[model samples]
Target chain A: MTNPIVLDVNNLAVSFQTFEGDVKAVRGVSFQLKKGETLAIVGESGSGKSVSTKAINRLLPVKNTLIESGEILFEGKDLLQLSEKDMQKVRGNDIAMIFQDPMTSLNPTMKVGKQIAEPLIAHIGLSKEKAKARAIELMDLVGIRNPNEAYKRYPHQFSGGMRQRVMIAIALACEPKILIADEPTTALDVTIQAQILDLMNKLKKELDTSIIFITHDLGVVAQMADRVAVMYAGQIVEVGTADEIFYNPMHPYTWGLLASMPTLEVGKKQLYTIPGSPPNLLHPVKGDAFAPRNDYALGIDFVEEPDLFQVTETHYAKTWLLHPDAPSVIPPEEVRRRKEKYQTVRMGKACGERIGGGAIGSGG
Target chain B: MKKYIAKRLLTAIPVLLMISIAAFIMINLAPGDPTNLYVMPDATPEQMEATRRALGLDQSYPVQYMRWLTRALRGDLGISYSTRYPVLPILVSRIGPTVALMGTTLLVSYIIAIPLGIISARKQGTWVDTLLTGGAFIGVSIPNFFLGLGLIYIFAVQLKWFPTGGMLELGGNASILSVLHHLVLPVAVLSTFYIANMTRYVRSTMIDVYGENYIRTATAKGLTKQVILTRHGIRNALIPIITIIGTDLPRLVGGAIVTEQIFQWPGLGRLTILAINQREYPMLMAITLLSAVVVLLVNLLVDMMYAVVDPRIKYD
Candidate 1:
């Protein structure tokens, strides 16, 4: 049997030495991704989603960061142990990342074609003419119309969606095994977000590239994730297939997230909201990090921490409620109402798959 | 671009106008007249009054200003009260040494500071960074006179490598080579401050640019670290560096009085001092006005460089 895991991140913990004190950013966060899977890490700001990915790239400054413990074994090599010189080779060859703000991530003075060709020259050793030709091909693959003309244009000359396409083109330049997209569509308009999502889905299926998508929008998680890992206070609180998380959430934080998602509930007077803020990781709790924000906290939640309890073969939850002796609790009524909305999503995907089963083979 | 130039030039007018007014008022407002400067100490009051009338100081303040402004526009800085030579030629002759010395020093300092600053920001808190930053602090804290004396002690007094004072020996014909020898100490004195301060600015700007996401993206794209620095960081850093040089050029071009005094370089600073001691108001006003104009022109040059660094900038 083939080994199922493509990335094995075991007990990874990270901290930052700030002026006030040492802020423990990521506390023993762990997860795994299989080949050709999309694992969406959903969290509020400072949940360590970005930091964990940056650690994978080894991009955090050494002066401030301390990766206290853990291992990130990609293809069985510890990424943290590699020197910066070696890391440069891994960055574009094995793992590549695309940032949220496309405008700031692209060098304002460089041509779009040249930016895309940079990785090809670095990793693939392509000459100027060959790189240019391949850059045009990548642009065409990303669905930029008239790719030949687009090659001569600079970044500022492109529209917002088009700029992101250039960024996507640059990330896909070397065709790495894994792609990390951090809020790729957060800055885009509503309509553009859908198109970019579709593009990413199509690209992932075509390239067979395992993507770790970092986002806070649950709707995006539903649309794009093969599996969802809900993160809070730098730890994974829930992990399951997208169907499991949206249709049948097992964690209180996951319930809160589902309830607060703004959608087409037209006549509702007020949108549901999660009561308290995400825990401040600078000074985290002794027991459960989400307990203060969670309303259904049991007595044990204040004194002892929760561990990941298996819900199904593919699902897990880190909550005291999952214990055999604990009182049974249900996700709030609003989450039950939201379940009907996701039923429509499953129907739409099922219809899409039945209409063109062969088309699903190539996402385009 | 036209809007930017027009706005900048319009702002500069009032500044130059104020400089002219201040130079005008202060030169005439000083105690004692140029009359006593030309006369012997034993001269009678009538003789002093007569000398003052001959030089047109007896005219009304408004009249003195008009006559002064007219000759100033024509480039006739009045004759120096001390040497009785045309102030313009004395200034003109000395311009070569001052420009050469200040120009060479500023150029060399930038050449050293930019690369050093980029390296420092790249290495950031390493031993080399610590040592350079500490050295820059020492360069900034030590007084110009002391630094000058120390350098003279090293190269002149101790090693006997360069001349102690003057651009060339007193009787020797000035050549480019002879001129270079005299430039070493005074230029070194003046540049110690510019280099020290600019490196701090360069370091800060480099750090800021390096922190920008585009730089991280550049590294990820597999551009070598040096390419990331010189190609990306330095071009962005140039805006602030150029601004400093432009804003500070007047002081450099005119030459600092203290630094000029130490080395006895025949630059604008020494001429201003000589004019002041003899109370030559017209010559003083002219030199001050010229310095202000040169500074304004340099400001314009710096504005032009901004668009070159980041072409996204546009003026409506």
Candidate 2:
């Protein structure tokens, strides 16, 4: 049987009121998180990947933040319409979040064990003693050795990687149905990033928890994502299965994202970069937001925004090049090379042999 | 912790020694002589010389300082040049009143300021915040002596609701109620400045703390606003607030100098002024040393409090 959908976000729009004007941070974004699967939203900075997920849990700042339009559906209830009092019941209990910066995410003054126990005591009405017992168990589950000894220590006593594990322990303390991790490993070193990613992958299977992993790291996306959604300028430009997005990316933006990944080649002169900065969100855009940056921009791309065109039963892309009437443009040679390399790695994995390189490193 | 305290105390010795040397040199260099207070203007130079010899001012600076230091180390601060009694006892008697006044003012100001600061920070940019911020500016700007006189004139002279000055009613029985009656005006004047200062400090510190990532984490944990504020906001804000409180400890004596002068309160501040005017070098030296020691100990206490409040700050 197919896994059920746990979270359905429809047409979500979020904005921030600043001195200049309203900043449309997230403009009409939508995605689904299926139960027991990992959905990775990949983008560059300011692509609104983080904002869309934070809006799901209602974790955006109260002041100056306006959710202009959206519906976050969880368990047949529109979370947007729920009062803050009811929303509290959902946060950290039904849905938990782990932030990017581990050093600052956990309260420095409070003990790590107490922090993990906070949600248990708040939502489940567990007694202090019972919560402490459960918290120690969670610490052990997150691979914290000597959980009893580490319980009394503060966040400052732990290293960056250890603090992130503590954050994960806190997020998973209440057995949340959906865990939104906002770049959870971006701040960690490469080796530590792999370990945290591995821990998350292992825990997701053990607990059967759905996850919305937001990051700009494609290597991490390759390792952790079951489904991938490529966001550009606060909109999902392309989305498909992990294999489809990495091996057969359709949108020019997705092509740039994959081509930008540093390959293990002997004499590649420089990495390909998408030219031009992202469009400023202070003012509304009349047509396609990425037209100026796209080298394959058609005349209509600058005058009219393209809707998502169906490429396959499971894949969709928002680019005019996929139109039947449009001329077929060839993707760059680097894009073709990456797909071939990834296919070879996949074949190696099937034969019980491991291949290590960029973009497809440590495939889960 | 014990080792930290001992190290702090050891370091304070050199600081105290430096302050003492500076005070002795400055006092001796001033344009006045102790013998001038004793002898008549028409007296012969030999009579003045004899008075200086008896007071040991005839000796060199080092000899005089060494003699005073030796006696001071023995807990004998010498007889006051003005009062003719021992300096330490007079100081001891005055300590009770100053402590009572300062302690009450600190308690009252914190009681008023903490809530006001939290409210001002919570309701930032609202009318309540604007009003408190404006009032704090005025309170901080207005001199304490002026505020004290204004309070005495309004509440004491015209309104006649509370006693004008002193720690108790004149020739009346020394009861708690009577002392409280007299404490009203001085406490009001002194605490106004403290409340204004602390309210602004707590407001800004709390505003910064509210923006910390931990607060967002607290919110994500589904904590109510009240719990988030008390548990996460205030506790983190308290680290900087404690620092300001420690720095303000020296202001107890500094603020009291002018406040006590206006209120005619029987405190060391008034005694200090009297000693300075009459050139009671022995009494002045004793009070200065006491203040220096108090300041050093207060700094040490503040350091200890840092360890208690923030786990990141481990003394050991």
Candidate 3:
């Protein structure tokens, strides 16, 4: 059974009023985060994945950013409509966020324990001593050796991976219902990235907190995400279960993304890259924002913006290719090979009867 | 930390010695003899030589420096040619008034500028920011002498609200009130520049600090705007601002020459100008040495403060 929805963002549009003009950063994005599941929003730089998640907690800068339209429904409240005073109570208590670039994401002047204790003191109204105790506990929970000693240390004293763990500790301090991690491991080493992802998975299971993981790395998505939302040019182009997005992605952009993944197959002449850059958001997008870059763009994609068409009960793709009247096109070879490899692995596992039935069922 | 301090202090010895040598040489090289004002113009060359000898100016450069350094080491800064008094005692006496003036100026400037700067950074492109920025620019651009004269004219001369200048009102009792009344115009002039400078520095530094990822993290933690600005923003911004303030410490004794001149306030700046005009070698050298020591010590203090303010900084 599906977990209950913890966060429902509907038609969220955000724009930044810059000197040139309004740059539409996030254009009509919608997604639901279920309890205890990690929902990864994957995209290239400036694709609005970070912006959308930042908007969830109303953390966007007040001076220039304008939420054009949206309703961030959390619990029974529309967070967008809540006053900043009320929103403060919701933030770090009901919802918390961890940012990328652990090197700069923590206060250099503050002790790590105090940074972690800040939310607890501010939200839970814990006494300083109690908060310190809890903060030490959290430091330990995040796998920091000698939590008591680490607490008194500053961010600079910690390594990049350790700093990120401190960041995660700070985010998890209040036992928040929703944790929005914006590329939490992008700035870390690859091996450390895996460890952080594993820690997050472990924490997610232990804490039962819903996570909105924003990242550009698909490998990270495969590691931690229960579901994935593929963003492109300020819009969610496709969203589905991890299995569907990897094995049976329908959107051309998704196909391009899957094709771009480097493989170990011998004599694969060159890696496939999606041709052209994302559309600039300065001027209004006339039709499909991705039409210029999309090799599989139909004639109608040039004149009309395609709606998110349903593929399966749990899958949806915003592309004209998903329409019934549209011409059928085959996915790239790499994507098909990936799906076949997964099926073979599944069959092998099934025949061995070593893995659980539930694990096999969940793979679909 | 103690070792670091000791090392810094040790390094300061050569630095102070070099400063003393430079000051001694520069003063001797300057036009006019210290004996010029004492001796008659038509006095014989032998008489002039006698006056120079008595004042210890006839000695060779190295010999004179050695004599001065030895005497200074014994707390004897020599007698001032102009005052006929010991240079160290005069400098010590002047320190009180100058410190009072500069200390008040620093306190008043930081107290006013810090809050305004924080407000300016927080309110950034708004009209409030524009007004404060414009005011700071005016404060920075205007000459302190002119500002001093303007205040003297309006408050002291026209309104007759305060004394025109001096550490205490002429013929008045040396009460704190009288001293404060005399302090108004000079302090106003001196603090204007500091307030303007510090406000701009604090504003720019804080604006940059606000952009730091930790600031975003603090905001994300749901701290109030005030808490974030004070705790995160100011705490981080303080690193550079402290450097600015620490560097300004030398100015306390080195004094605001123009401001002191305009106000006629009894401070080291006034003493310095007087010494330069009359070629009071001993007084000038002492002031120069004091200033160098202040600068070196302040540098050490600021470096040490960095360790206190930012745990990331290690003395080692």
Strongest candidate by DockQ: 3
- What local lDDT score does residue A280 receive in model 1, on the 0 to 100 scale? 66
User: On a 0 to 100 scale, what is the lDDT of residue B164 in model 3?
Assistant: 82
Error of 2 at B22 (Å): 0.6
> What would the C-alpha RMSD of candidate 1 be, to one decimal place?
4.0
Per-candidate DockQ vs. reference: 0.53, 0.67, 0.82
DockQ-based class of model 3: high
Which is the winner by TM-score between candidate 1 and candidate 2?
2
Model 3 Cα lDDT, one tens digit per residue, B1-316: 9899999999999999989988888887888877888899899999999998998878888998999899999989899887788888899988888999999999999999999898899889999999999999999999987888889899989999987877875575799888887888788889999999999999999999999999998988989888898789889999999999997888989888888888887889898899899888888899999999999999899999988998878887
DockQ-better candidate, 1 vs 3: 3
User: Against the true structure, candidate 2 has what lDDT?
Assistant: 0.88
**RMSD, model 3, all Cα superposed?**
2.9
Model 1 score (lDDT):
0.82
Q: What is the interface RMSD of each candidate, in Å?
A: 1.6, 0.7, 0.8
**Error in Å for residue A281 of model 1:** 2.8
TM-score per model for chain B alone? 0.91, 0.97, 0.97
Q: Write the per-residue lDDT of candidate 2 for residues B1-316, one digit (tens) a residue.
A: 9998999999988898889899999999988898899999898999999999988899999999999999988989888876689998998989888888888898899999999999999988889999999999898899998888888888889999987788877686689988888888899988999999999999999899988999888888887788888888999998999998998786565438888888888998898999988999998898888888888888889989988899999888
C-alpha lDDT of residue B19 in model 1: 96
Model 2: fraction of native contacts: 0.62
What is candidate 1's lDDT per residue for A14-115, written digit by digit as tens?
A: 999988888888999889988899999999999999998888888888899999999999988999998878888888777888889987888776678888
User: lDDT of each structure?
Assistant: 0.82, 0.88, 0.88
